[model samples]
Target chain A: MTTTEAPAPVRTAPGGPPAAVRAVRRWGFLLRRLGFYAAAAAAAIVLNFLLPRLMPGDPSSAIVEELQRVSGQQVPPETLESIRAIFGDPDQNLGEQFLAYLGQLARFDLGVSVVNFPVPVSELVLQALPWTLLLVGTTTVLAFVLGTGLGVIAGWKAGSRLDSILTPLTAFLSSVPYFWVALLALWVFGFVLGWFPLSGGYDANLAEGFNLPFLASVMHYGALPAATIVFSAFGGWLLGMRNMTVTTVREDYVLLAQAKGLSRGRVILRYAARNAMLPSFTGFAMALGGVIGGALLTETVFSYPGIGYLLFESLNKRDYPMMQGVFLIVTLATLLANLLADSLYVVLDPRIREQG
Target chain B: MVTQIMSDTDHDDAGTTAARGADGDVLRVTGLTVEYVTDGDPVRACADVTFTLRRGEILGVAGESGSGKSTLITALTRLQRPPAVTTAGSIVFQPRDGGAAVDLVTASPRALRALRWTSLSIVLQSAMDALNPVMRLGAQFADALRTHDRSLGNDAAWARAAELLATVGISGDRARSYPHELSGGMRQRASIALALACGPELVVMDEPTTAVDVVMQRQILAQVLRLRRTLGFAVVFVTHDLSLLLELADRIAIMYAGRIVELGTASELYDDPRHPYTRGLRDSFPPLRAPLRRLTGIPGTPPDLRRPPSGCPFHPRCAARFEGCDTHLPELVTKGGHAVACRLHDPTQRPQPAPGTSTGGAR
Candidate 1:
């Protein structure tokens, strides 16, 4: 029915400002996101400073006791004093100790490792970081890419036999403990089949370089652990992506895309999978952050020289400084990854850019 | 087959009327039955529905909620998802290129894709949800444009996209913005522009203006009318608002349950509704110019398609019930320009018009 009221004026400008001002407004969201990440990192650093101090036992005495147990010789008082200074002076107030800790962090001086007396905690961490990053990081990216691709297909043809087979299979694989799968993979591929090295990151006797033999040996050592991680981890990505793709496929935009006469591939990939992958990005970022810590149980089982193994060794040795260094690194890495995800999301979803 | 009601006198444009009379059968849906296959039994959502759309014609399908209006739209476009399947009938769409008419129900996936955008497109209800939130408006338009024409360069396609936006009164620069950037009304208009990107012959709209405010609704409908005048695409607009259809559509089909109960020219349905249900719907809306009156909504909710009422589906709610009303189903019988499915209008049952004799049904 015709109305007496005149039609309202159309929204000509999306914003009130002219082009230059509007262009400046676009960067406001990114600046705000950076501010959030910086705040989170500050909070994480404060917590890192406070945690070890709050623990009951002094790390110095623990080191002294361990030294006596190992050598059967009484440790000197000066040694204890030096260890206390290296850890954090028990004499100073929490405020002064916190300031000192921050200073050390700023200088990248994480103190000496208790397990290997004069070796710096940062040096130990640096040595182990690359192995874990190469192993777990590569596997995580591989699993995500392959799993998401299969998921898009499976979800697009949800009722087909391919979907029918993969859906239950992934459901089962993802639910089983990955460590158990790692053990099984070790028994089958390493122990029984003798195809891969049973333990370690690379051949101990190989001359370390970017040479062909060393790289091949590294791959040879990494293959069993990588396969096990991918086998167990891929299922989760596939299931998450499949579920999301199934839901996204039902979205009005996806339906409209189909109605637009787009090819089936276009509908599945650009329309369905593109939106579906948004939720998975957060998960993938967290997984990337965990890559810095490495897959703990899998690393222990493989006897790989990674951050996870180093942390496990530090825990057994009661090496507080090493553990604290690893924890700080892990926390910072997680924050950085989350920041990356948020920025990536702004690129992927334009709605986020408008909220600011 | 239900009778095709093309009221030559109802059209204001002489050129359109002449073109329709020459060769206007763009879409002929014959006995199109759609059913939802549930666990217990298959529920018939659209049972034996038949209608024909002429070139450049606007056929408005008006019904209450759960009246299978949406179901018919999806079925006609062959966009029905799982559980809902077209078990019978054919949607014989004749392309404007003078190609052979192809039945959509039996068409291959490749054939369906070819028809989309170029020959037949859809403008869905919620523009916010219908547009790709991640993609820019211009990119989505370019996608459809480049897809149909492989020879179109990327820059040219984008230029064409901006031009399409301009048709809907959206500025060329706004096409760079995302769907969320534009207001609700603008997004709906953008979707309309997208649907007309390939110059489709038939545009199936399912309550395209339901989500917007009254002012925006009027603006969008007005824009649709303006565009249809120039592009000349047939629209099958489905909505629950009969009064809106009375103003917009050339021919209005009123659906009750899962079937078209009455269909006629907009004026014919308004001035003299043949079926009792259509009369109830017409009276439900408050007249724009008339004095104040109590609105009389049709009694009883729509029947459940899972276990629909026997005989005439509307008989249980009928104000003019007589012998054989509950026992026998009525067929859609056309008298002059109007077609109605009711025992009261069935000449075979009544033999003659009964005046002031049996029931309290309003004339």
Candidate 2:
């Protein structure tokens, strides 16, 4: 490189403040994206406000009626109005109610739940959040890691025995619905073999603090349900990643890496797999976001105490506030996950970087 | 000197060896044949191709697509993978340090590993695709350096990479940017810089300038020549464009249907090509400074190597084909450092196409 004579050279000068310009453009891109997400969030909240009214029954009315029947006394009309207000009155003018709902949202008050009267919807979501995060979140990540790793190998060695066996196996497993997977695992492991407990997030015998026994019980009982969701979703990640890896293997960079005399391992790791893993990384982030909503069927089958189980219970009781609260959380979390992935992808792929 | 004789197959005892660097021949390729084994018959991508790349010389390979220009380079570097089998020939590389000539066709994996990047390297065609997208330019350069020389520190490797980039007239922190951040010309130049990172004695380039614009291409070629003069490394440049080669190359090899039809010094082949295919190829490039001659595209497609025409492979498209051209094959005959495989230049052949006649009245 030092040998060039520089004869007849036409040197283009580096422009001033190009770096600063690039940074400004990147920041602009981020601001624009934030604005777009804000609109999405607003739309989602408005939908959340309207969706609870469409539920078949009302939680406040059911609770009030049950109370009156049990006590053998009619509830006062003023008290009835206050109970209705707590769960949102569907009879109110739609436009005015939406504005009022937005006003209440601004104050960080999600209103008290009628089903669990006097308990705020926010506290309910908070209580269930960690369990869902632990069970579903961990499983989703495990599935992605296991699937993507296998996928890289399969795609790298497309016609090998590993690919031939795993491709169809994973494809078949992917077709099994969540309920079926949970039910089948429950029947075999819990009922037939009795090697695992049938249902519940923790052992009925243990106390509910942070002791080792209770923690062990949570995982022990959570295992079957988690496996159901993870195994069912695992195959899709594997197939998607395998297909991506196969395509990426043919990319010119992989060939270039080989031409540079890098070892096969370096070529596969640095060139083939790194590029192939981009789509999988984005998929994993999106999955993580959505998993916050909880795996409904798996949770329901296992009677697990996650957000999905709470959603099911609230829906069964026609608990409008609880349903609305859970739905809003799910929507917001999913949106946030997608946005984070998009930003990270921009970081990973320079082709889309700093091009505001 | 155990004189190397390249027979029909690449695996035939690798022929022989000699004091290869004595006459400045950095690479001696003889009877190299690479075949693609399809379901039916094996297609010959490169067939019995023989040539020598001298020290510090730019040997340009000019041919249309499917003319085996790329395959020839792939064979020379042992980069040909399965389905594209090297059926014949030997590529004898004379080590720059005056060590015994190593036959690349027979070099063990460990030996090849050690020799690569140090003595031999390659620049792929597409600059954008050549660099790893996920990796920063500095890291990619570091990767190339660390692969062969593991003892080199990161800072040293990065400094060397930055130095290389500077020689290509890129004097900035652009090495820290990804391939996409750099312009096409810059990326190509970076690739060139990487090829020179280990100070290889010979660099094989597969259309290095084809991906960049014409202006950039000229600049890169000029830089390559100047670099070659200073670094004293031989280059085997392959491209479909002949005009660039005519201007930049010291010597040229014209391939037709997997075979080198003519090999000569750049000016000799440009002015007085004896092979009809070579003449057609030369005419195809619209001469820039000379009198304006209408550019005539070659009349026919390249012959299918799976079932190639017998005798002379270029006979179907040759404008000056004699009767013997369709019946007898002509071996490359050397005269005054120029070689042409055609009856017109074959002193032993009789009744050649009548002198000055327009090829059997075909016009």
Candidate 3:
């Protein structure tokens, strides 16, 4: 029994703009976000250029000292000058040096790695970058999904057996140091059991391509390191999500949803978990940005040929160009990840869209 | 024992405006009791609440903060959460489609799920919180509508949602707005509209207009009355404000501590309240248009439910308490159209009063 008569309409604000026009307003918000990211990137780039130059001691001598320790070889004067040339002359006017740095950056020329002499810093970065991104990026996402899903179940049934088991177990696991866990995993699974590869990103003999054999080999070798990282990381997400879900489930809207006669699954997922995931979503974005820096100790323990391993080696040998290049990539990746988070938030919460 | 109050003729007369179908009663709640089970003693929040709501009647439950009015509502709606359990009760609901009446207290979860929204719905207080802040108004409505009847496609569900919004005087287009986007008054109205989405026969409203301004409260009450007129749904309105209920409720039930001390027609309760507690409540609200009089609000706080007072729960605060009142619990005694749970009106407590000599009401 529905009424057909027209209702007396209340307070029409000239009917809000059509969908297309509203969509453009959202773009205005996105454009503002873009402007913020651009300025942040510019600031980071300037710091990338200035930080190495402002470092104590000559870059060439630091390399020479490391080289002598490694190879027991003395660098000739000519070789020293060539190394200094790669560093763009420490005494050059600050403006001129900055311009030269910007010009080199524009062409993606990060100069040459001192330790891997004659090899470009960009090339070394590119080689290590993919390994780090693939391993760490995929594991981060997997941990987030698995953790959040479990958290929803645990929090929804807070006093049940599953909740009791998961809560304390994850809490203890997350509190343990990451490197300690990684080392333990390596020793137990790799050294003792011999169930997985002890070190490296993939089998060295397999050609690195899109083929299934190569991909399988990579995963096989990457498994222990990936598992360790995920194990240590997922706990934090689970605990955070569990706490948030506990609070969100008590919200009046969730109760209202239940009273609406919606299914339990719908109440948990759409009404409870959806809102609870907001803070966790932001944390996940930050974790993703950290992935570019690589799982340092995990990679070191595995000798995984990722960015973290490369960074460690470069630092040990005082490879200034390689260090500079890696730092810049980390900074840029963090900024981009934050930008992605801001954009995704607009999609997830309509409240943010209005502000944007 | 639970007391079934209200004269049959008066109840039928008050409810006749929109009563339909063969059976006059839509809900029959008998010996309904609710308790808060804590670490220590379990506190009885509602003790032996018995009342029958007729089709298309507004039964207003009025009480102070701790008087179990809200508990009674939650128990009726079967929405009481952990620690608050319906220990004993039978919420017998007769469905609109002439189906068998089901006792909600023992209804299976699957059965309750089927009955919810279709036969029973609730409009909660604090509309800002009751409606999901993140979801668009239409989507929430669509969710409720589609879940009950799977035949309606997404488009059809959305169209119905817009129609529901329209009935509340919210433009159909405004259904796209989130709960946070609407004015407080509008959000409450939207919640009211959402409750009516499935055309529920009974709507249990728990202080639905408490969060809005006075003007909005009046508008919302007027809207509720208007909607009930067309839709013919019964309402059990629970609030602390008796004055508001006087204007809205066909019948008012005044609760003291955990028991309903008096239940009668609004005019009867207001003009000639039989129970001392009900009189205290009526005197608490100064008449709006009438000249101001010194208000003698209730003297004492409601007793702690964990260790309630012996005998009559209201005797400690009651001015008219006699010797037997503190020693023995009083049953809600009905005489004519009014019912009062007081020894003063208990016919067995004293020699039977001659006809028309009672303290309140014309017999």
The estimated TM-scores of all candidates read 0.91, 0.89, 0.90
Candidate 3: regions farther than 4 A off: A1-25, A56-91, B1-22, B350-363
Judge the docking of candidate 2 as incorrect, acceptable, medium or high: acceptable
Report i-RMS for every model: 2.8, 4.0, 3.1
DockQ score for model 2: 0.35
**Kept native contacts, fraction for each prediction:** 0.69, 0.50, 0.54
Overall lDDT per candidate, in order of appearance? 0.84, 0.81, 0.83
Worst 10 residues of 1 chain B by lDDT: B10-19
CA lDDT, candidate 2, residue A238: 93
Local accuracy of candidate 2 as per-residue lDDT tens digits, B1-363: 323333334323221122243457788887888999989989999888888788898999998899999888888888876678899777888776767777888877777777788889999999888899879898988888998898999999898888999999886477777776677898899999989988999999999998888999999999999999899999999998988999989889998888888888899887887777877888777788889887676788998888899899898887777677788988876776788888876667846437556443211
Compared with the true structure, the alpha-carbon lDDT of candidate 2 equals 0.81
TM-score of candidate 3 to 2 decimals: 0.90
Q: How close is candidate 2 to the true structure, as a TM-score?
A: 0.89
Q: Report the error of model 2 at residue B211, Å.
A: 2.6
Model 1 RMSD in angstroms: 5.9
